[model samples]
Target: MPRTTLAPTLALMLALASPAAATQEYILPTLFDVAGVAADDVLNIRADPNPTAPVIGTLAPDATRIEVVEERRGWVRVNTGEGSGWVNSRFLTYRTDVWNEGALPQGWQCFGTEPFWAFIPQGDSVVLGGPDTPNDMRKVQSVLSTGVFRDPTRAVVAEGMTLVSTPQLCSDGMSDRLFGLRAELVIQGNQPRMLSGCCSIQP
Candidate 1:
């Protein structure tokens, strides 16, 4: 205290206040999407709300099913089937309308080429085959024809994984068909790691 300078004292105060200032809270949007990553780098899925936390798992580029749990200080808590962890908020995008309507469950990442025709189940993996007929049941048969059907013998779907399924249509063949075939695909390894969007029938 004998030689305390104003500059040094101010610096000390700033440092102590930095932690509190860095902590911020944001309301999470209903449906969020993660994109813009290469298909190689391990998307670090962390346990704590901070990036410095221990890595619990990694998300492949083609992994589309991630459920977000909570948001704290620019960090989002999400579930990746294997466990729960945090991801930086910068990589996320939110859709309130879709989420509020129960179209997308909480903690799950909703994605599709079309807005609302199809979505991947949360915490599951999907492989994207080529584009298919929009909302057409015949496309499901086509995907199966490509030999991407779910293999009961394979382990969990991983990066570079592809699957084909014709989900039952939820609506009558009338205004806005609600059902269509979808290919949930995963792309991992190498640069640009990412979980691609679901390629489905057009809406």
Candidate 2:
């Protein structure tokens, strides 16, 4: 390359490497891991994005695969027991392995009350069990989602069931744990029951 062209090319490369360009790739509805806390210490979740905010909950020092819903002023919003809280972003490390191309994350679980139903994804089929329905496995058909890479809306279609999860605050109604995604499951049968619940990427 000529000297005149080299300067502009080098400048363009540096510009793309800047922090501003990197921020575009960092989006919400992503996973995070607890970091910078001692083994005996716990990370506090506050009610607001300030140091003096009321403490809402705490996370174990070794907690991993935490879903962060939003970020504000160096604080990241995470779901705690039945609610959302903010934690200092400095203590959480982002995870690169995220749900992409409409694929569900590993160990994804969905459950609901008012009949007590649960959907568990196994190797190639989805195990659906409830108090009323028979415990049966359905073959996986396809997973679809929005075009945006970071969007947290996805649908899992099977032989007789379609499970759709969207980015929203959800509660199990019995537990104090808040959830980042709201799940709706439709079972195609004689009755065609529709169930609503919450989902979590964490265990």
Candidate 3:
């Protein structure tokens, strides 16, 4: 992490003025894993993106080499060997860590400074609002899926997205509750933005 506060010195001023003073987060894409579910909790490869879509097949156990077909309305169309169907894109990540628990943390309720943006992770989707957003509809969370989060310090690529804090502490105006956060976010393929303020994750 870059120094949060710079020292008061002539050399420090020059150092702060340089472009290196601001760092862009890097995306380290990896094979995303979708496991750690009970038999009944297996991901349902649906015919479409909506929950009402018919279930074509469940995700095959130990399935690898999966291909991303497309993404729409926060759902990703994948060609899993068992079948081709739409799954909640947010549920799918790009990391290979195994978490055989029920449901994992949703994503984040993160904010930035200059062009302030807020990401609220609600279950399988996110609610995004920021300076560039023009209206409520535009605030919909549909960030491209780059991969899941891994690595100890969260230095991994979320060129997709990630879970940062305990879900319980992730509501708005609760920066006081956020804990153990490494200030970084891979918002998209190329837009690796820095976390400017408080951030949290939801389960």
lDDT of each: 0.43, 0.85, 0.45
Off by over 4 Å in 3: 1-31, 60-65, 81-83, 96-203
199, model 1: CA deviation in Å? Answer: 27
Instruction: Provide the lowest-lDDT 10-residue window in model 2.
Output: 21-30
Residue 58 lDDT in candidate 2: 97
Can you give the TM-score per candidate against the true fold?
0.34, 0.76, 0.30
* TM-score between model 2 and native: 0.76
Among all candidates shown, the one with the greatest lDDT: 2
Q: How does candidate 2 score on lDDT?
A: 0.85
Most accurate candidate by TM-score: 2
Candidate ranking under lDDT, highest first, comes to 2, 3, 1
RMSD of each: 19.4, 4.3, 19.0
As a TM-score, model 3 comes out at 0.30
Query: Which lDDT tens digits does candidate 1 get at residues 1-203?
Result: 64677779888889878955654232332235566667776577787878788988776655553444456798876655434577887776653333222122333322444423333332333323334534211111111222222111111233343343323222222233232222343334475323323222221
Q: What is candidate 2's lDDT per residue for 71-186, written digit by digit as tens? A: 78999888886678899999999887786776888867789999898998998889999889898899999989887656668899999889998888788899656777899999
In angstroms, the error of model 1 at 198 is 27
